[model samples]
Target: MARILIVDDAKFMRMTLTNILTKANHVVVGEGENGKEAIRLFRELDPDIVTMDITMPEMSGLDAVKEIRNEFSDAKIIMCSAMGQQKMVVEAIEAGAKDFIVKPFDENRVIDAINRVLG
Candidate 1:
């Protein structure tokens, strides 16, 4: 189990992710609605992993990835993307996300991605 931070613009997505992580026995350290809060929470929570949506207000997930990676090189980020956001996914990876899970999440994929990144 890992300390996790879930970030997404939609409350439903956040709730869904939280449920999945909690069920797997991971500690959900925090939740955030935008990249600004993502960054702020990262510093405060220091979670072992973060699941970040690629799009959000105030700041984009890509920018947040870069900012967090800049400060914490060991930060492990998993990008959450919707279909047809392949371009943003690449940018997120280039910006320092460790892995990705497509939207309309699959429990297996979500858990697998988290495990892969944590490992």
Candidate 2:
């Protein structure tokens, strides 16, 4: 099972993802509320993957992706975006995210993304 870090502004989102990941037998290493925390958690936790929310207070997920990729070229990240945030999702991928899952998250889709990225 892959170790994961979840970063989202919404507590409910984080809990949802945690439930999904845990039920899939993945370990959640940490949770963060924004991009800045995402970066710091990545450094400290060194999880197998990260799920990052596209928009947050301190920094955008796009920026976090860029920063993390800059520091750790192989860091695996997945962007989480709400419906109609397609442009931001694309930008996140360009910034170095491996893949993305749209919200509100679908269980199969989320698992598929994690498996795909891990592979």
Candidate 3:
């Protein structure tokens, strides 16, 4: 099981991801509502993986990914984006995200992404 940090602006999204990840036997070590919180929690929790939303208040997940990667080059991050956000998803990958999941998430895809990144 991997330690995970989930970051999203929507409370429901966070809860949903927590359920899926926990059901898959991954420990949700922390949660954040924005990129700023994501960065802070990452440093504090040092989780094995992070699921980050691209559009968020305070800071963008792409920026958070860059910041986290700067500090921890090997940090494993997976971006969560809405459909039609291909540009942002590409940017996220360039910024250091290991993978991405499109929202309205599928539980199987989420689990597969986490496993692939961790694998």
Candidate 4:
């Protein structure tokens, strides 16, 4: 398992994701309530992977992805998107995100994305 950072505007979403990852034997290094904090935590915490939500206060996840990619080119990022955001998902991949997970996450899907990206 790798060190993971969970970034989402919703407290409940962050908490839920944190619990899930932690239970699955991954070390959840930090959690971010917004993209700004997410970017700051990324540098401060230096986690092995990141799960970043699409919509949030201040910077959007897409902006954060670009910023993170600019500095940490080798960063492993998993964009968290909602269904029907196909274009945005494609943009995220173009911005260097490793993979993505859909909203209202399925445990198995999340794990699979993480595993595939990590490998």
Which candidate, 1 or 3, has the higher lDDT?
3
Off by over 4 Å in 2: none
TM-score for each candidate, following the candidate numbering: 0.98, 0.99, 0.99, 0.96
Across residues 1-119, which tens digit of lDDT does each residue of candidate 4 receive? 99999999999888878888888899999989788998999999999999999889999998999999999999999999888998988998999999999988888889898899889
Give the alpha carbon lDDT tens digit for every residue of 1-119 in model 2. Answer: 99999999999999999999999999999999999999999999999999999999989888999999999999999999999999999888888999999999999999999999999
Clashing pairs in 1: none
Local accuracy of candidate 3 as per-residue lDDT tens digits, 1-119: 99999999999999999999989999999999999999999999999999999999999999999999999999999999999999999999999999999999999999999999999
User: Which stretches in model 1 have alpha-carbon errors above 4 Å?
Assistant: none
Give the local distance difference test score of model 4. 0.91
Q: lDDT of each structure?
A: 0.95, 0.97, 0.97, 0.91
Q: In terms of TM-score, how similar is model 4 to the real structure?
A: 0.96
- Kindly state the number of residue pairs that clash in model 2: 0
